[model samples]
Target: DQQVKQNSPSLSVQEGRISILNCDYTNSMFDYFLWYKKYPAEGPTFLISISSIKDKNEDGRFTVFLNKSAKHLSLHIVPSQPGDSAVYFCAASARSGSYQLTFGKGTKLSVIP
Candidate 1:
């Protein structure tokens, strides 16, 4: 069974608008959540992350929020731009300090100009 799941296969947002991607996890041991953005023919790059202890984390135009009790998390991008279009993967790891991660299927985000 997939521990992490991205229900929406894709999303479309208008430029200068907000883009929100959602992820859900079934593994309760997961204590950290990360978002990765991947462009075509390139490796996934780390975007933003949040710990189970905190409800939210932000950097520049990206923000990640975690709801520990709900086993849900979301990434929000404000003023979405064309460059922001990519496949976003949601990943999780336990507190065991292992580098290994469980990843969701990913949500492809398209920002329309």
Candidate 2:
């Protein structure tokens, strides 16, 4: 079974500062990883992702790093803004053809201005 852990329930960062969210997993079968940002009453929006073959993937202000050896990953947000404050989820999927996603509880980010 696949299990994801986001030990930190929430994070607080100053505006324009950097924010780092951590995630850990117990499943090696996962081949795809993703980060999503969610707001109240709205569905989560995709942020970034990394394939099992890649250790790191970046897009604009977001970067996702995966450590296959330790089954761990982290998402970094540079120059965090107030609008960036939202609940972030770390999700994983396997290439077993099922195409199912397993998600961590989530970490709420608070970017204060």
Question: Which candidate should be chosen as best, given TM-score against the real structure?
Answer: 1
Model 1: per-residue lDDT, tens digit, 1-113?
A: 99999999999999999999999999998988999999999999999888888999999999999988889999999989999999999999997767579999999999999
Error of 1 at 63 (Å): 0.6
In model 1, which range of ten residues has the least summed lDDT? Answer: 93-102
After superposing candidate 1, which stretches have Cα over 4 Å from the reference? 97-99
Q: What is the C-alpha local distance difference test score of candidate 2?
A: 0.93
For model 2, residues 14-52, the per-residue Cα lDDT tens digits are 999999999999987899999989999999998888999
User: What TM-score does candidate 2 reach?
Assistant: 0.96
Alpha-carbon shift of residue 77 in model 1 (angstroms): 0.1
Q: Which numbered prediction scores highest in lDDT against the true structure?
A: 1
RMSD of 2: 1.1
Cα lDDT listed for each candidate: 0.95, 0.93
